[model samples]
Target: MSLQVTTIMLAVDDMDRSKQFYKELGASLGQDFPQFASFELAGGSALGIYPLAHAAADAGVPADGSGFRGVSFHHIVDGPEAVDKTIATAVAAGATIVRAAESAGWGGYFGYIADPDGHLWKIAAA
Candidate 1:
């Protein structure tokens, strides 16, 4: 079977805050609701944000958890300069820089930031 991912859903404590952050990162709003919000991303992929408590309950898991989810979302940009600019923009939108943009060991430039709900995102040079 061939598997393809068209959407990524994040469990957020505050939907409004998460939605605003993604908007600042250039995602266009799609469907909006009190418990959920969807955003259209590049390449036809989509991002979904839902209430953490509801998500956990729906999945039959505990809602209380913290620190490193062991996964990160990546955004590719045209070049190293764009990486820096993206990082700055995220910070201005209330995201915390987990790592400063710099040369990557793989010969690219990248940085990481955590959104209001602590989801990690990597802004990398394409």
Candidate 2:
């Protein structure tokens, strides 16, 4: 069997804030509540936000601590021009540029940005 990921649920401290963050990053709203929110991402995948406590409870484990761990979501594009457009759009939508756009070591154009809640996103064209 092959593994296919359909959704990614990030455990956040605040649902409303997380929801707004993903929305600004161009995700369409799916399901939402005081405790959680889900966004429709590209390729039929989903981005979800759930409270830290609840998420940990659901996982039957303790949180690793506050602040972001090293995790990133990505937006893949087609060319150098598309990379520029993608970065511009994400910036205009309120994402903070974590790293300015540049040529990647992997022979692509790439950049990094962060949502309001500090979630990282890598926008790239290969």
Candidate 3:
């Protein structure tokens, strides 16, 4: 199969709040629908937020519980300060600062934050 990801969808508990969170990170609203909100990012791709229960139903699953899921979205920046700035912005926008910006042992600086809907985001300068 020749396929490329055209969009990344996050199952959000609140679409409006999620849209605001992404907007604070420099994304602009691209589409707004009854059950979904899409954001146009720097690149050509898009970010989608949909109600968790509705999304799960559309995907043929029961949204009765939660788990780590271990999915992380990475955002690459130009330098350590950029990483720090991004993390700070995310924090100010109501994201949970999972890891404070710092030098990584892997020859770079990085940090992590969880969006309003608990999606993990890694900001790195490498």
lDDT of 1 by residue, 21-101 (tens): 989878999999999999998899999999999999988999988889899988899999999988899999989999988
Model 3 lDDT, full chain set: 0.89
Task: For candidate 2, write residues 1-126 as lDDT tens digits.
Answer: 999889998887667766776787678998878887889987899988888899899999997665567778888889989878877877786678999889988899998987766778898998
How would you encode candidate 3's per-residue C-alpha lDDT over 50-112 as one tens digit per residue?
A: 899998998998887666778899999999989988899999998999888888899999999
- At residue 43, give the lDDT of candidate 2: 82
Descending-lDDT candidate ranking: 1, 3, 2
Models 1 onward score TM values of 0.94, 0.81, 0.94
Model 3 TM-score? 0.94
Report how far off residue 84 is in candidate 1 (Å). Answer: 0.3
- Per lDDT, the best of the predicted structures is 1
Among residues 3 or more apart in sequence or in different chains, the pairs in candidate 2 whose N, CA or C atoms overlap within 3 Å are none
lDDT assessment of candidate 2: 0.82
Model 3 alpha-carbon miss at residue 74, Å: 0.2
Off by over 4 Å in 2: 64-70
